[model samples]
Target: MKNLKIDREKVLLGVAGPVLALVVAFLLTALVLIVSGYNPFEPFELMFGAIGEQDVQVLIINQTGVYYLAALAVAIGFRMNLFNIGVDGQYRLAAMLSAVVGAHFSPPGFLHIVLIVVTAMLVGSFWAGIAGVLKVTRGVNEVVSTIMLNYIATSLIAWLTLKDQFGYQAEGSNDLTTGEISKSGWFPGIHVSDLAGDIYGFIFVAAGVGVVYWYVLTRTRFGFDLRASGASESAAAASGVDSKRMVLTAMLASGAVAGLAGMPVLLGQTHTYSQSFPTGVGFTGITIALLGRNSPVGIAFAALLMAFIEKSASQLSYATPPYPPEIADIMKGLIVLSVVISYELVRRYGLKRQQSRVGRELAAQAAKNRKEVSA
Candidate 1:
């Protein structure tokens, strides 16, 4: 269990900023609703009533797992101060190729799952490695490269799916899917009842990933060098840390984790990558990573909160007379905006505070020495 007591700096930076931003975002959303002529409280009331239902709870848990993986993937890059926007492309490509590989193979049950996972990680790492290589060798910016990769991945998947060899066939097939994966490949689900969807057993996989992320980033020497490079490339180089290798490794790690972002949907539920497969989760991971301040525990809570908001707000449209569903989108946007702004302001304040404290300490020390000389 975490210690109940938090230091002032942690409270200010981690807790205060997020809480203030959330409060402001909600206030702004309420204003938006009022100006647009709707009863804001009604939607919240309706959403709160539905949020506790068995099915809704299951959805929140399922989505939280996916989002958590995505956030962890993004956080890996973030710790190195690298922006990896290609998670969308990485996961989608990984899921597709992994699915294809899984369909063709007939290994032992556990080994089959292992092979599929390894395929995904390899594909994701290779794809992300392109950006890493470009950055190291050609001085290209990762943000630009990753964005371009996302577009490339989209088009590439389209072409591959249309080819007969990868399992594209009639347009009216059960789904825009490959041949069904055998039961051996499927990750068993935790059964509940008909009313609530079974929790994906792959949730344990997500939990394991989170633990590894925290351990590796906090405990390992490579983690120290990676963070040192992020802080100052010049300082790291002076200390014999290879900034280029760190960049490449961080990107590869980011992409490898990104590969797992879609596995729950594939191995746990869908069993294939198709046109209807979940998309845009990679992008959502970026948002969650920022909201969670790139901390593992924070990301977990943020993921669940985001999933909960989406799950609950969706019910507004089904209300007796109906409330606008777009309200949820507005709330999300406002919260992100507010949080970004708040963090910047708090960071500046913290810097100024440190400067003031240092100045006062030096001045006091000098005066004390002068007094001693007079004595």
Candidate 2:
């Protein structure tokens, strides 16, 4: 009963942060709308109404999968006290190379897909490992190394996708692309309704990744070591945990997951890496990871919320008395800011509550001791 109560309290406290953030964000966004001579409630109404459309629903779910994967990648580094800011570079580079391989080869049925995914993971890990190696060997900060790597990766992709290189211009289109993968290599999608289109089959893969992430972090000795090292390297060292190795391992794991972020679109939809391929997902992952508090379940919800906001934002300019599409961007920015402030506030409040409880218990014990002495 005591344990259950403690767990319940922890859950409530955990939830309090995000809830407070959303409330504050919504209010702030409304104020902005009012100042801009727009109806704040109308935007919310339209956004909520957009959810009724089957196609929009499908888009949200599919995008959520991508966001979830990216956020998970970021969360992995966060858990190890490492800031892997290059997830964008890692995943983009992985996707491009993997797409090239998929285009060039067609193995057996499922084996083809497996090969592409494995290739992507390997590429992502390799890229991220550079930052990790630099951090451990040369005492480089991951933030600086990863940021530089992102630029390097971007330039590398641009070069590799040139017409004479691994890329080709499709007839009737000027956009450069890594030629399409064989149909056998394409991931199958789940059909729901004709209007809705197929949901990305890789969503299941994302879910599995989340389950694995939760299990590994909570159930394994390595997870404990990683967590301990993140909490305090000196304390972890005293406990015989190797901090450098853990940092490297975390980066590798993070990059591997980052590799999967683009597979949903590549295998399930586009079937190729092109100039139009999505970007900035890795940076968005950082926001989601922060908003999710680095938990799998929390990240899932955060991903959905972000996806919904993005999808809903697309219709703003087309609506009656159309609002600027930038409204959504404003809301997102406010939410991020609100989340940071709200979480800090909640932390301080919880700390004070805990301290008060401890003081009360001490006082009660002192009173009992005084009574015993008088007797």
| Best-matching candidate per lDDT | 2
Candidate lDDT values, in order: 0.87, 0.94
Candidate 2 has an lDDT of 0.94
RMSD of 2: 1.0
Q: After superposition, how far is residue 33 of candidate 2 from its true place, in Å?
A: 1.0
Best by TM-score: 2
TM-scores, all models, native as reference: 0.94, 0.98
Candidate 2, residue 78: lDDT: 96
What tens-digit string does per-residue lDDT give for candidate 1 at 67-91? 9999899999998999999999999
Please estimate how well model 1 matches the true structure, expressed as its whole-model Cα lDDT. 0.87
User: What is the clash count for each candidate, in the order shown?
Assistant: 0, 0
CA displacement after TM-score superposition, residue 62 of candidate 2 (Å): 0.2
